[model samples]
Target: MEDINLDDAIKLIKDDMHSYELLHDKFLSYINRDPDLKNLVHSYKSRFKDLDHLKSKIERKNHEDSMLPEDEQKGPITQDNIQERITDICGIRILHLYIGQFEAIHKALMKYVNSNELALFEPPKAYTWDPEYSKTFEALGVSPKLKESFYTSVHYVFKPRADSNITCEVQVRTLFEEVWGEIDHTFNYPEPSKSKVIQEQLKVLARVVGAGTRLSDSIFELNSLQDAE
Candidate 1:
């Protein structure tokens, strides 16, 4: 990684910025055109990763790898591998109003993929689904979940078409989860929060967010029962 020139890498990213912008617009159009997605989401947003942030991320990853034991270390990031290694240079986020909507939106996405309405660069993956959340979704019979850190989102790596080399990451999360994520990212990201009080509070807030989601789901379930009655 040290052997690779940072200037050249930044140039590569800057030169490709226009292409990413086009890809972002293309994705936004698709989301808007899909009636199910348009009606399900509370908000939609997208961005191209800043050049400095990209460089810092590469440096951070390499630094962390250096600190690991030899057998555990992931390989370094070099200019040659940067484009292939970093997947989220272009990101799109879809925010839903409630937890219950995730399953429906997820199902819509699967149908889109199966029908070839969208082209995926790789298999879809969900991030930050702890055991409790997994059990909750499993009971709903929506989708299988993976346990990870405190965050929560469904991510898809895809291109305008399979033959296109450029890829963008699409993320889906509830508005409640997005609020918590923004707070966590502001205070604890790039580096974890140093204050134990703040750290503990964030964890507490995560639980609160979880409960809020459950409550929202229960309210919908109750309304459905009443409608049926």
Candidate 2:
């Protein structure tokens, strides 16, 4: 409602864990109903569990912090600075099993969320593996030379269709890749000493992961070949 102020909304959300979960589920329900997103996500049942876990973690973190005294709490939400600018405050990431699934999912998602339906979902920023990263593929000796491009994932942002008051981020990636990437992201990979040693180490680890993916693919292919024979 126009009468509702941004500060009140943010206070309710940031100060109360229940309020936050309520809002998150409300949005997730919307996403699940979306034909393209629903199918893509539901294909893997574990994904729903992952989503629930992620949601719970955020809520728990908030609930813990809210116990602190008001004086210790951060700034007010109603500030113009807060209302006008939007950033990566909320996020959801969908991890797939293979690279082939990436583009398929991407296309479907893009088709689902039109330019108009979006009040604020930022234009999809899609990135696949970088050419430099794929160069490591040769070290692992992936015949046919895996493309040099290795991408972490695709990111999408949007305002809730039902309510334009809040924003959310969506991330998509393959399962193996996401697991590996999560390690790096969680630990702050390539450790910032500006040391070649650290960079090389990360590159090597990344290559091993790539090799694992290739090996998995080969086994799958071999099984298919066996079935055909």
Candidate 3:
């Protein structure tokens, strides 16, 4: 594919923006209708990438990849890479009350993908779920002492239907994790804060959030045990 300039790319995205909005609505409807999924989630939120934000992202990726010529770096960027390259143009976030609920919801999503319940545009194998922090969280089993990137969300990519190419990203996180994410995103998103103190404080807060989630899980387990008697 020939390189198309940044203006052309943004135009292409804007032209198809309505379709992405429709896909987001379709996703919301699907999740609302699925009893198991609805039960697992404490809240659901979604957004389409803002045009300016999308432009910034493409420029950032281009710079990171060193794809543009040195002299043309600040010039009109050209690339046919925007469409397939950007995965989260349409995105949804699923917040669960506990960390334990992630696995069940993930499994149900896989089942939906396998059964073609959402009219998948691609095969089930195309979905991505290999975030390092989530793997560490599962491996460490919610221990307070565990130290890894506090980022804790399982992400999946999907299309609203088999015929569309627009991709939506689904992010699943526990309530505690969501709290940390919001604070972090406010001060440290798109780029991390330069303040050493804030960075350290965020790390400490992450540990606290982790501990809180563990306590919540324990309380639920205890209640379940009590009910069994």
Candidate 4:
């Protein structure tokens, strides 16, 4: 896939000549109805708006890899990079504050998308069994397909009815999944014919990491119970 340069990305984001407003409106409207999602964006936008605090948080988490390199950076304020930043004409992130909140947000999103009757791009292998956690998504009425990477997320392709001029991609991911995504972002996708050994290795890693997360959650719960007692 050909990547858009920083300059081109800025032009796309800045040009009133470009129709980003409609895309933004559609996404905002979708999220506005959900109390959980609205609060998430509000919380993030507030905290992330603080440059020093935001920089410190990102630095502490060691997630600065998502930022564009100096050579790849654009603009005076560096305000724009929508293409690379959001991966869509309209980029919106659905954040889950607690790990347990993922399902609620996901269910809300499904309802909103279904109501809007948007078209989606379903990859053949999208599955959503929380391997590390004791609870299977099957019990939650979720059987989302599983993609290969450790970061578990779904990407949907949606286009507007009024104009087919623009296309948007929606990425649904848990917070932990985003970390996994960043770790593997540099890797290239597999060819149609891929090695089973490579695939097996990745799957094994995913399970192990997921189990670790579940254990952490379990321990936290235990501590909470002890405190209560």
Candidate 5:
């Protein structure tokens, strides 16, 4: 595949950045209005990708592709398909307190997908490395993919229509996982961490995050059962 001229690609993205911001606001409003989603989410955050971060990501992807053998490398990002290739230009993150709550939150979001209000740009991904947490996702019909960094979250990609260039990615995770992710992001962004000691501690923190979610779920469940009696 041919390389994209950095200047041309950046110019093209800069031109379309406003539309992405509009799309971000539109999706954010939808979540705020949806009754089921409003109750299920403890809080939410949204942002369109920053222009400089997009430029850096393009450079990084192209560079990583160059290091791989010809047949193994993914094609370089091009101006023709940069917006389509980078699906998370606008992103919304849904955070809740308990793992038990994810199934309801996911189901509520899927309503938009099922109704085609938002076209499914990619299949949903559940990210985690814990075997027990993996089963939690699988039981709700989402397949778990092992995240080597042990960063845990569930991601969904949606676009306005089946072929729309404007897209948004929604990430669902517990408050506990959110804390772990922020720490991982600090170490691994722009460059991977060379510090093995830091990596090991992050892995340990991931387990603690999972346990926190489970413990929160258990407390809610027992309290509900008692109130019903």
Candidate 6:
């Protein structure tokens, strides 16, 4: 690929910005109306990356890799590979009520991938910190990555079809976990909290969030059993 500076990359993205917006809308519309997915989705939010943030991200990523050997470095984002490199121009977070609903939700998302209604940019994996929580997912055949962060979510990158390079990142998590994430982000952003006490509190809070999810799961299970009775 020919060398392209930041300005050129930005121009390239700007010129084709309309098409990205169209792709974003196409995905947003699908999630809103897709019967299998919509019912399970408690709520969702979608966005295209802000241009200013994208610029910063590109610059930071390039700089981070600048020290590596020439052959190993991914040079600036050029027009040729912008869409492929910046996969999450359109990102959606799907929050469900309880852990019990995840299997159905994952299956609904996979149905499209299996039928070619959507294309997988990558295989799905669950990012988890708790061994017990991870075991639940592992039992279902979806591998869990043992990440150190409190972050937990199942990620799927889907393209509209085989022909389109445009991608949407979907993050699925329980509403309980979503609340904990927002609360924990306060101590983590910009830098981790300087206070060791705060760090310990956050860990305790994370465990509380996990317990809440388990309790939610149990309540839902009881309701289902009562219905069967």
Best by TM-score: 5
Model 4 pairs in collision: 126-144, 126-145, 126-146, 127-144, 127-145, 127-146
Candidate 5 wrong stretches, greater than 4 Å: 1-3
Stretches > 4 Å off in candidate 6? 1-4, 66-80, 139-141, 190-196
lDDT per residue (tens digit) for residues 1-229 in model 4: 1232344534544553245556556666767766767754322211112222323332322233436576764422222423323334455555443455556665665665566654333321224446533244545544455455444654554555323435455665555555555455534332222556655666676666566556656775787899999
- Residue by residue across 70-160, what tens digits does model 2's lDDT show? 7885533333433223333555677655544444566555544554444444555544344643443333232122222233555666554
Residue pairs with clashing backbones, model 1: none
Which wins on lDDT, candidate 4 or candidate 6? Answer: 6
Cα lDDT of model 5 by residue, 1-229, tens digit: 3556777877877887777777677778777898887888899888777877778788789888888999997778888878778888788898998888888888887777789877777788899887887887888778899978988999988887787787788899989999999899999987879999999999999989888888898999999999999
TM-score on alpha carbons, each prediction: 0.86, 0.53, 0.78, 0.48, 0.93, 0.84
lDDT of each: 0.76, 0.50, 0.70, 0.48, 0.84, 0.79
Q: Which regions in candidate 4 have their CA more than 4 angstroms from the true location?
A: 1-21, 28-34, 40-91, 97-99, 114-142, 148-151, 159-166, 189-205, 216-229
Candidate 6 residue lDDT tens string, 114-193: 88878888777898787887887887777789655577788888887878877888889999888877777887764568
lDDT (0-100) at residue 180 of candidate 6? 77
- Model 5 accuracy (lDDT, Cα): 0.84
| Candidate ordering by lDDT (highest first) | 5, 6, 1, 3, 2, 4
Better of 2 and 4 by lDDT: 2
C-alpha lDDT (0 to 100) for residue 19 of candidate 4: 51
- Clashes counted in candidate 5 amount to 0
Tens-place lDDT per residue, model 3, 107-179, is: 7676666676555433322111224344544553322222344555566678765666688888777888889
Quote the lDDT for 63 in model 4: 34
Error of 3 at 179 (Å): 0.8
* Tens digits of per-residue lDDT for model 1, 42-127: 89888888887777778788888888989998688776766667778899999987777877787777676677756777766555
**In candidate 3, residue 64 scores what lDDT?**
61
Candidate 6 structure, TM-score to reference:
0.84
